[model samples]
Target: MRADIVVGLQWGDEGKGKVVDYLASLYNAVVRFNGGPNAGHTVIANNTSFTFHHIPSGALRGTKLFIAPGMLVNPEILNEEILSLKQLVSSFYLKIDSRTSLITPADVVLDKKIEELKGASSIGTTLRGIGPAYSSKALRISPRVVDVLNESFDFSIYKKLYNVEFESELWLKNAKKTLKDYASDVREELLEILSKQGNVLFESAQGTLLDPIYGTYPYVTSSNTTASYAFVSSGIPYKYSGKVIGVLKAYSTRVGKGPMPTEMSEDLAMVIREGGKEYGATTGRARRIGWLDIPALKYATEINGTDEIFITKLDVLSGIKELKVAVSYNIDGKEVENFSPLENIESAKAVYQNLDPIPKLYASDISYIIKNGWRAAPVQMRKYVSFIEESLRTKISYASLGAERGMTVKVE
Candidate 1:
C-alpha cells in the first residue's frame, strides 16, 4: 500500500511526534526520511514521555522503525536513545539504512567552530553536528553505516579535514556495537512491504520552513524537510506516496534565529510561552512565539501539496481576551496576500486581524471534544478552526487539545 507522510507545516516544532505516535498503530512500518540528532520529536505515551532524536516516534507503538539513507546517524546519541526506549517499551523493530552517514566527534566540533566563527550571523543551530555531517556526505568523504561495520574503515581524512583529534578506535568500536545488527539496505524490504500492500507511515523531521531548498535560505536546515522529499529520502517511489498530512500549531513558534514576521510582543510571547511550555525539545532553548501567519501557512501547504491539516496546541491559546492572526503582509508599503521566498521576509510587516478568543478550556471541555468530535468544541474554537481551514482552502482532519495521545479529536 501507499505510505502517508506527516510533516510540520510551520517551524520544526509543530508537535509532529505526537501526531505520528497517535497514528503509528495503523501503520505496518514507520520511516524517518531525513535529518539527524538535531531533530527532537517528543512523544508522550502511557504517561511516559519519550524525546526521540534518532529513533522514529512510532517506537512506543511497536511499529517497525526504519532510518532511511537521507538521515545522518550520530551513533552515540542513537545508541543512548535505543537503550532508553528499551526500558519503556517491551521491544522494537529497527533498521538503519547502510548508506546513512555517521556523525563523528569531528563533525560536532566543526559545527560549533563554524557557528562560533559566524558570531553575530550565527544560525543558532542545535549544535548537533547536523550541518557538518550532511556536508561530509555531499563531499563524498563521510563514512556510511556500512563503513562503520568494516574493520578496515579509515577516518584519517576526517581528522585531517576537521583538524580535530578523533578517537577512531573508540568511535569505531561503539559504532560497530550499536549498528552492526541493525544496519542494512532497507529499500528492498520497503519495496516488499509495498508489494504486499502493507501500510507504511513516513515521518518527516524539521518542517517546510526549515527545508534547505524551499526554506529561508542559509537560515534553513541542512536537508530537505518538505513532504515531497519523503519519497526521495525514504527510497520509495513517488508513485507510492499517499496523503500529505501537514501539522501546525494553533499559534506559531520558532526556535533559534530566523525571520518571524508575525512574532508577538515580548509580553504576550511570555504569556503564551509559559502556557504552551514553548521550549525546544532538543536544545531546551526558549522558542520565539508569534501569532499564526496565514500567508506562510498557505505557502507551506502549497509547496508540500499537503492533503490534510492537523492543528495542534489549540488549548495553549486559551484564556486570552483576544487573538491575532496574520492575514497578509505589508512588504515595502505593498500589501501582499501571498508569501514569496524571494522577498525580505524579516522586514515584512504583518497585517493581523484580532478575533474573539476562546475562554480557558477546562479538562471537561477537552474531554467533551474528544468524545463528541470537533463540532462539540467551543464556538470560538470552532470559529478559529474554520478561519484557518477557509484561509488555506484545505480540510483540517485532526486537532490536538493536549499533550496526551487521547487528547486529540477528529474534525468532522
Candidate 2:
C-alpha cells in the first residue's frame, strides 16, 4: 500500500492531527487531500502546540507536506500558514499542488451574501468562501492553478471572472483584491517535493460525515474528504495500497449546525470538553458533544474504506462515572437500524446505555476493555465500537489513552 489515508471520524474536532503527527513518522510524504482553509487541526508534540489549516497536519512533523488540488487554496491563509509553520522549526518545508484552485477573496464576499439571504438562520459558515470556491471550480468559473501555467490560458477569462463572475464581482466589491490577480503555478515546486519524498500520508479534512454528497445535507462542506479524494487531488493514480487509518474519538462532537441525536447536556459536554480542550482549532468554537454514535461511525468507516481505526480522547471520560454510547436511533417511531439519514429526521431518539470504565485506566492493549468493561459495554454504553467493527469488518488498531503522543496504544 503506497497511499495511507487519515481522516476525522466525528463532526470536525476528533483530534486527527495528533494521530497524524504521531504516525507520520511511518510515512514519507503527507498530503492535505480536501476541504479548504475552513477547518483547524491542532498537533501537540514536544510540549508545544502546532495549529494547521490548509497544510496537512503532517507539516507540523517537519515532514514533506503537499497541499493537494482537492483543497480550496486561499493564498493568503496558505502563505500565512507556511510562515507560521516555518517559525515553529528551522527545517519545516511545505508544497502547494499547482492543480489546486485558488479561492479569491471575492469568493468569500459572495458566500457571505448568499448566506445573508438565508436570513436569521445560517449554517454558521466560516465565511472563508470555501463553499463558493468549490462551487466555482465545479461550475468551471473558478480560475484553477493549472490555468495560470497555460500559455493559452485566456487573460480575458481572468478579466471576466473578476469583473463579471459572481465571485469576482463579490471580491471586487468586498476586498481591495480579487482572485484573478493572484493565480500562480506552484506545480513545479510541488513536484520537486514528491521526488524527494516516497512515503506520502494523505490527510483528509473534515470527517466523511461532512462530505458534500455523503455527509449531513446542507451542513456539509463542498468536497469529498475521503481517502479517495487524496488519490484524486494529489494526482497520484490508483497505484499504491498503503494503510488508511480513520481517526475517531471515543465520543462524538460537532460545532456549527447539524443534527446530533446523541448530543449530551451542557454538564456532560463540559466534562468531556475540559479533558480534551473541546474548542475547535479553526473556529475556536466549543464543539457540541455526544456519546459515540455507532450508526454514524459505521457509515464513516465504510466511506473512507478505513483499513485501521484509531480511537482518540479515550481518557476524557474518566470523570463520567459511566460512559454512554448510542447504538441506534428511533426515527418517526420506527426502528432505523441503518445509519442512513431519515427524511424529516430533524432529530433522532438515541437508544443509549452506559458502561463502566476500565479499572486499569490506561492499558497498552485493548484487552483491558474486554477484561473489565466488555460485558458492561452492552448494557451501559451500547456496543457502538463493537458494532462499528462488525459492520465495517475492520478492527480498530489504536486507542488513544490521552491527548499526548505517548498515550496511544497500538492494538493488534
Candidate 3:
C-alpha cells in the first residue's frame, strides 16, 4: 500500500526517466502503467545513457519492473529493450501482465495507414501503432499476452481489426517467440509486494496534457495519462496511491501537431532546444519549444493532484536574457484564466510577463539558489522559481541542472 506516482506535467518528455531512475533506489518495484513503445524514457546512470521504450526506468537499478495490463506492448520492442538492458544491468527482470494488449506488426502498418489518411491533420503520433492497438483493444478484437502464449488461442479475432485486410499469422508467431518467457499474471505479483508493505512506483508515460479524456482533443495519446489512473493501470486500490509527483520542464516543448500557446519564436526556440537536447528519444524529431505556460501547468496540477514538482532542464535557460511566463491567454480579445479546449486553444494568444535576466548559472550557483532564498541569486531566476511556487501552490522538490544522475539539486 505504499505506491507512489510520477507523471509528466508538461507535454511528454518532461524527463520522467531521469527522475524515476534517481528515485528507483527508494522503491522495491517500478511499474509502467500506461502507453507503449511510442513512449521513450532515457536514463543516464553510471556513465551510460539508456533509452527505455517499454521497460521501466528502474530496470537499471535492479528494481523489479512490471508492464501493466493497461499498456499496449509491442513484443518486438520489449524484447529488444530487454536484451539491450541486460547488457548493462545483468539482473534486469521485467514482468508483463497477462492482460496486456499485444501490438502486432499489422497494427504498426495500420497505424501508418491511418496517419497517412489524416494527411495535414495527423495527430503526430510516434507511429509505433499505439492508437491502432488501443483501438483494437476497445473493439475486443485485440489479443492479449495470455492469448499469445495459449496454444489453442484463436488468431482470427484480430482479423476484424478496424476492417483492415491483413494476415497476422507471422506477427503472432514472432510475438509468441519474443515474449514467451516474460508473460505472467502480474496482478498477483504486485499484490504480493503490496501485501509486504513494499514501496512501489507507478511511472506513467505521457503527460497530463496528452491524456485522451482531459488533454487537447484529437491531439492526445489514446489512454488516460493522469495519476488517478495509476490504480486502474496497476490493479491496486486507489487508497494506496501516496505521493503524486509531477515532473515539469523549466520551459515547455511539444512534438507533432498541437495548439501551443506559449511557443517561442523559431530562433529563440532553437536556442533552448539545442541547450536542453530537446529531441524525441524514440523518433529523433525536434520538439517545439515555448516559454513556461502557467495556465497549462495550473490545469495539469488540478487534474493530476500533484503533491510536489520536479523541475528539469533549468540549465537550458542559462543564456536567455529575459524569461517569459504565460500567465493567462487572450482568446478572441477576452482574457481567460483556464486552459481552453482544442477549438478555443487554437486561437488563444499567450499573454506573457517578463522577468529579470537569468545568467548562466553554475552547479554551485544552483545549489546556493536552492538552499537560500532567491534573494542573492539572479533577479529573474528568483522571480521565476517564486512564480512557480506561488502559482501551483506546490514546492519544487528537485531541479535537474543537467542530464546526468548527479546533476540534480535537491531543494531544502
Point out where model 1 deviates above 4 Å: none
Error of 2 at 248 (Å): 0.8
lDDT of 1 by residue, 1-412 (tens): 9899999998889999999999999999999999999988999867799999989899989889999998899999998998998899888899999989999998999999999999999999999999999998998889898888877668788788879896789989999999998987778889888899998999999989988888887889999999888788878888898899999999998888888999988999999999898888899999999999999999999998999999999999989877999999999899999887789788999999988899999999889889988888889998999999999999999999999989999988
TM-score, candidate 3, is 0.95
Task: Put down candidate 2 lDDT per residue, 1-412, tens digits, no spaces.
Answer: 3567888766767778888888887776777778888878788777877788877777656676667777887766766776677777887556565567767766787778878988766777778888888887887767565554453233356445545344443432322232333333333444454466555677788888787777788787788877787766766666664777988888888888878888888987897788668887877788888888888887887777778888787666654666777877888888775676535445678887666653324343334554454343322223444554665578877766666666666654
lDDT of each: 0.91, 0.70, 0.86
Shift of residue 386 alpha carbon in model 3, Å: 2.0
Quality of model 3 by C-alpha lDDT: 0.86
User: Which candidate gets the maximum TM-score versus the true structure?
Assistant: 1
TM-score to native of every candidate shown: 0.99, 0.83, 0.95
Top candidate when judged by lDDT against the true structure: 1
Candidate 3 or 2, higher TM-score: 3
Regions more than 4 Å wrong, model 2: 146-197, 358-392
